[model samples]
Target chain A: MSGRHSKHDLETTPDDKLLRKLEAKWEDSPTRVLRWHKGLDVRGLDCNSAPGWDGDKDDGGALVAAHAEELSELQERLFADGRSGGSRSVLLVLQGLDTSGKGGIVRHVVGLVDPQGVQHRAFGVPTAEEASHGYLWRIRNALPRPGYIGVFDRSHYEQVLVVRVEGLEPEETWRAHYDEINAFEAEVAAAGTTIVKVALIVSKDEQKARLTERLERPDKYWKYNPGDLTTRARFGDYLDAYQELFEKTSTDVAPWHVVPADKKWYSRLAVTELLLGALRSLDLGWPPADFDVEEQQRLLAET
Target chain B: MSGRHSKHDLETTPDDKLLRKLEAKWEDSPTRVLRWHKGLDVRGLDCNSAPGWDGDKDDGGALVAAHAEELSELQERLFADGRSGGSRSVLLVLQGLDTSGKGGIVRHVVGLVDPQGVQHRAFGVPTAEEASHGYLWRIRNALPRPGYIGVFDRSHYEQVLVVRVEGLEPEETWRAHYDEINAFEAEVAAAGTTIVKVALIVSKDEQKARLTERLERPDKYWKYNPGDLTTRARFGDYLDAYQELFEKTSTDVAPWHVVPADKKWYSRLAVTELLLGALRSLDLGWPPADFDVEEQQRLLAET
Candidate 1:
């Protein structure tokens, strides 16, 4: 069949024939959505998978599982080094909508890493004291010290997201935060602190589905906040604001990745990739051997 | 029951009630034996009830459980304060025998604190790379930044304890470490970091009981090392060294608390009291109200 004819055939077939669909996508890799970064218009890049771009979800899951393991190993090695040297450190920021899988993503990323070296922080509504300080104050205090990896569940972006949506601040003040955030991230980057920011963007429909699941399961009731539905009512506004802010703020110093959060598996995969990409940027190594043999012998004899 | 007869009865009884026993030894406080201080005579403190004071323990379980709840509460309050403030921090150091409840203490301390503001690190044997650096380099790096509470499971004391025990360094070198540690801790204290040091001491009999349990449970086999038995065999010498070290090392700057490890409940309670004393010293308070009328109006408008 001609290339054009094969492409046409793919468009009408049922998706269960995923192997055939993937083959066609690979054949058309140069023009496919998965490889759609050629133009580099990050804004225009169609993150959504079309007929050909959609492949085996299981493959995606497997890829995530594999990469997560690899990343976890790297994270552990980094942690071991940091704990001993006690100098360099890392901070991972997870910014995603509800059910974008912040908690799950953290579990996978640091699953194999030593819990000793990794710190997890979940940012909720600011307390009255947190509000007394600048928006970044609470977050600034939460950054990890040397030789550790700090993970933020919902980070300082609440300044731009919730505070903005809630009209907690004047338009002029909150609008200025994009630059302020960019500056803050740049400062952390300069401090030998590596910051990996991930924005999990699930579709409005997916969010509603997750909310419904929470309502149906008694175990998930703690996660169900009636306030979230009120926020759901303004979902479109939140998305528009988030998209604009993300576009304006993603930078070379601290780039932000908008992961396709509709599928938890895919979200996990993209996040692992992002984390590996960030950590790989750092050239870390194991500590060298330097015990004094005679001294060690003497100490052993004393024992 | 004449007073003189009752006092004579108490003197002859081997085991008094827990609180009374503790009070009887309050001024002497053998728990202080585990602490780093000057003037302790480990060899002299050797007795059946004071087994941990002379390195005669195979288990420290009861000592660990004794202080779990209070330590748990203090950790919780520390993290809560951290969440409220944008910049404040604390550090908890656990140093003890091979099975002196370091791991158990870490688990209990961090159990209730939010994973975000609290980071736990267990420092063990130096790697090839770590041995090349100054002894305290690795530990210095793990200090939590502002608004964090970093727990060190083993910590820098290995220089004085294990290193000295193993004769890894000259007497001059290990002896010098006490002052070095003092200076280092003073600096941390000056930096608004509240440092709590706990040493778990278990009687040899108790240690043997725990070792037996570890052997009986397949899952705990990994925790038992044949080398520790050798250390136990030379227990008297180790105790003498520890006692001398603790007596000379414990100072007004950073006082050491030698917690009895035979009864987990008693040990846990002592740790709780210590933490409560430390945190209570900080004078933490809720942030004053900060929302202005306009901000309240915005919230009202949304409502």
Candidate 2:
């Protein structure tokens, strides 16, 4: 308990074997794991860290594959248990650099459940309408309803990360987002949502390779936007911003996990494990039969 | 073409065969189908009419089952086509008496697609925050993003139907919703979303029988609310309200379809076909590949 499920990781326990294997296999958090530039030194910490897989992509893939069925079942129970009322839900807040496989996480990882159970959104630039309100306005509206799995591919954290890095707000305004985000997450969690935040830690080299692929591949061209390069040029600034983000935002109630995402398979598996862990921690079970099953079965047969 | 695709039908051609069978088999609009008490006559139509299937539930079931795979594929194409920045989405607005099977449509019909493609919401009573804004404020936010299918279980129509019947607002205010709704639908349609509204026509007798079943069956108790009987008492008034609704709100761009929903299978097939038609009308295809596929394929192989 002291070394592993320490107070920093909060009190989450993996929901199933697959999630357990994943947690055991990875560097728990990037905060301690590669030494993220303690105050502008900008040294140590390899972006390509895939801590638990022994540098073996196949092993990670197989592990995730093994857990797929159970993960899906757990998700179903999580959704069903939420229906009786209360905000019993899970909101997986995914934040990553561009081309960091957010879409893939949505499709391959979360896509395993019934569509009726999800309310997924990918937050991009705020529309003029959305921008009129506080940054958290549209986000509050998108919070998952009771008995749902609300996936935010990118979320309110942007107010601090991207907004802070790009000077979208004055320095004072951007600096205020840390407490704002924490307050927002705490409110959502108090409302019966288990908030699991994951940052896909991809290397700059990997992002460059991905951008090159988009240029080189016709099918991927639609996904390419010129704006990505502007963000890429300011990578160092963003990295510093993220480091500051971890320092200010990681909380006891909603801890942030920076999963090494250079390996798409490894990152996806780790994220899945984290989500399953949150769900399992809830001890979700099917809502009790609303009526007498035996009598209903007899009546159904009569019908 | 004149009789087969009458102007009254509002000019829709199904996107594929299942949809064709569905539309060809049912009365195009329930407004005309139900003998809506047109000022004391009360003898123009019956509440239970399935014009196309010889009133056989099995035929409808077989038809829907036949088109299941194709419908799923078409939905995927519809979703994939919308990923590029445009309003190419479908909003299926369902209005019906309770237990007319809105949840069923979402589960059995819409459930076939990858959940990533859907943004399904069931609108109940507006929360305190929602009531603070104009009714449409939250609605506009809930509209499906491009490349998604948005299914509103109960929609803005409730503003006119339930709110009007119960006098939640003054006569002057509820009366104003007609043009307000028409303007809203027109705006949404003009922006690229094809709106297909369906009113599930269930006879009072059928509703009683269904409600009775809910009481008799244990599994369905969760679905029952005593308040449904109060609404049922106002059935005649509600019918008049709906008649007025159809007259003022149905427009060429976004018309209403009334399907005989006494038979669950028939209504489900009818709706599936309607959605398939809307998707088909978009002529959605994989967003034209933006990069050189051959080169990417070659590079992909090298990697």
Candidate 3:
């Protein structure tokens, strides 16, 4: 694995190095992924451009529009194969802070797949009946069948993110979930399910602007919760809690991709690439017909 | 209302009569709709087609491919709008019997929508926990948010379809869900969610060929369950069950469009039109920004 990494880590390969650099830079700051994981002050990032930014908004929009089409096409092909073949499944889990754009990401990424083959489950406040069961039960039921793709707007990671952030559960209970999630995902992957985990990262200022926008916009007023303001105020604590989460749970089976969500288009592009990249790795294809073609043709003609 | 009907029915201009005839001819057979509502009996469908019936096989393939590309491009536009605006949501529900081409319709229809705006939920047997709650609870929770689109492979209608068919619930419980569903969908629509419901109707002979192919193909073995045969054998009971469902549940609020699934391409085409039609009705646009053209021009000059 290290040798494989070294091959891709060629000095002349600027793209690989740039990606590595971005990942490292994100790792150092750490706060973005943390805010996403801890669920303490989950604020959505501003996707719109900043005033006086260097980029031309038209060009930026065009680039995003093109990429969106590519990703959308890839998702459609993958979905068609999955629905028809019935051999494999895919699960995309998004964990992000309040307004971290988990919903946004899902709206964009899973939206590309066929509604027949893809399933989306948003884990909110557990119902009394759901709460009665073990923590992972509801999550388990939401898993897609063979040949389907399931997207979790918020997922089993909540046991670690929210329960731990609010101290709603004992230390041991939340801690146990990291292993449990990894195990559950492993089982899923082993059953031909591809799991992609993403944490939508937003900066404090970006979040503040979004929350303010939400309050001002009449159409968006429905999404603004009064409690969210208090959550936003404790931003630093949320950061720390999330940083701890990323370090512990990011694993080989289901690696966490920290999406730079301040640029919503960029975030959507990255997530789309991540998913398409995963599907490409699967080498999916239409299943071959079983019987002899000529014989079947002859038989049908006789009938 | 009767006068309006009489104008089209008894005394119409030639153009109007042609239009009415066209509409009536295109309207799906109630029996075809029932075949989908009840699981399909694939063994019954006639498998007698001349050489090369598969759409992917010839000159017909070229035409279909071109048509698909056009649909795909339209879908690309929808996705761009969905990601940017994120204001209105769409829900497409596909309900059909085994081999009725629910998956096929999903593949084809979803092939047309922007992946960023659509969420697909495939509802199956409820777990003990899910069953404990009202049947529609899990389905409702999976509804798409504002500016998103949700597609359900099997939906809340299962309360009427499966529960009623299997005698899992009393007549009153399953029967009343028709009104309950209408109310539920109305609420979602009021909340900016557009519901597009489709029942894929495949001929009995087309179904038989599909089942035989499923049995013969190793890769398709996963889709072939022992229960499907038992269900297929009881086709008449299922048809009666579904015809009643369609008659009672099809309403102006969220009318059920029956797609001809005998031809996979036709099914895809019909569903794609129905879905795109619903989205088209939304009249979505980019959020208006307070942009000053002259000020922005000066800003660009400075850059």
Candidate 4:
């Protein structure tokens, strides 16, 4: 209402100019959001890079708030579209090393929309049952049904990432998973799920600081996994695994986004904006009402 | 402890004689269980017939009890075996006309196992999303994960059965589904899932009687779907649909069993026995312990 457009116009617009404006500002902002393309040389990419948000914690809060209303309304349209024969949905696959503020992204970014609209699955060590199926089997089951946004805290990448670094399976076994995973993602996309995968890149110094803080604070102990240090010690191997992961899996259908996550607010805002872009790309509209609206209006007025 | 042989012996036996003995009694019993084989014509099959249970309600109760303990034990072992790495499971696909006692079989037959070990998905009208994918997409999502007994209240056969009878889609569409379903089941079976399908056959009069009873009782109103009567009106079309369903979709990986379901008690027992036979065929053994037993025992004793 305050700008050239009305509130309704903002809500219904396919690609709202406001969203594009905010995104443009984000492009030049201190905190950097990395978009993965085919044949990305992840080795050259620096984990410490932020879009360059060197401001205080409160920085970018106003921009996130500006887009919040549109984001919320767009999420509803996405849900409604899916329910009404659209049969389409979004899956945000979040993967990163420990203490990369994965939880913050979930809490601050995704938390803006209706909770019921989001399906969250946290992948842990595979159950003997899950392990029995090809690694991607449980993934298929956890996929969001139509009319919902699905978030994977960690995903099938474990087959390549942790499994590779830990030497849990023979190199021959885990190595083949990259292609299988690519094919699987391709199939899932072909079946109508738009996949937006994000890797939260945190610097080693930043990770050390977060882990040390967890140790010092009793409140954060529950979030702490001692295994994180073990994983961190093999950071080079893990980084190489991720490099291969990006190179191999960043397909046209489901591309991976690598965002520097040293700043929690910047990362959260980036993810929120990333999801906004994904949802907007669907060009979702409100579903038509099933019942006779005129008759319902008459009945309600009479009652 | 009271049995003549040890419990371990019975569990370890490839095919227990006692189970076979009970199964043998079932073969000659008045209430007959339908076993479909290659080239068997389903048209000749009698819906009104049941394995004769001349005795009162208590007649087969003892036999059911006899197997209950072992069945329960075997189910736990199946769960444990899967947890250890076997990744095996059984899917009981139940199909039949209205008032065919699919619910009763779910309750009385499948109810014998631990609730945690059973994955029951009662499919209803397909969501727009489900229809967008091939008919089997939702079915795949509903499949039993490893280490569980999965039950389909009604299944993909509806595409060939109800969808066919009602002309919900073109003849070309429903006709192509049978081969697709067969190939799908074959893959599911090859993936370590043992599929057992049963259609509880109740005659027209029996369905009529059940529907009337539901109409007369206020308590049973919830179970009554008026659409069931409409479905009953087109019985011949449905019957022809089934005959085609049996002829096409039944494969080595998953087969259809047409059982006499006029008698709930007898049919329930027959289905229970059918499932038991399927599970026993897997020749499951308890998964070995993960820890060193003697050392753990010594540590506990010392403590």
Q: lDDT score, residue A50, model 1?
A: 28
- Candidate numbers, best lDDT first, in rank order: 4, 2, 1, 3
For residues A90-169, write the lDDT of model 1, one tens digit per residue: 78888777776787676555543445657777888888999799979989888887767788899888878888888988
Q: After superposition, how far is residue B233 of candidate 1 from its true place, in Å?
A: 13
TM-score of chain A of each: 0.79, 0.85, 0.75, 0.88
Model 1 spans with C-alpha error above 4 angstroms: A1-57, A60-73, A83-87, A289-303, B1-95, B98-303
TM-score of each candidate's B chain against the true B chain: 0.74, 0.85, 0.73, 0.88
DockQ of each: 0.06, 0.13, 0.14, 0.01
Candidate 2 is graded, for docking, as: incorrect
lDDT of each: 0.61, 0.72, 0.61, 0.72
Model 1 iRMS (Å) reads 9.9
- State the lDDT at B199 in candidate 3: 68
Candidate 4 to truth, TM: 0.49
Off by over 4 Å in 4: A1-303, B1-24, B28-33, B38-44, B52-57
Worst 10 residues of 1 chain B by lDDT: B51-60
TM-score per prediction, in order, is: 0.51, 0.66, 0.55, 0.49
Span of 10 residues, lowest total lDDT, candidate 3 chain B: B45-54
Superposed by TM-score, candidate 3 places the C-alpha of residue B158 at a distance from the truth, in angstroms, of 11
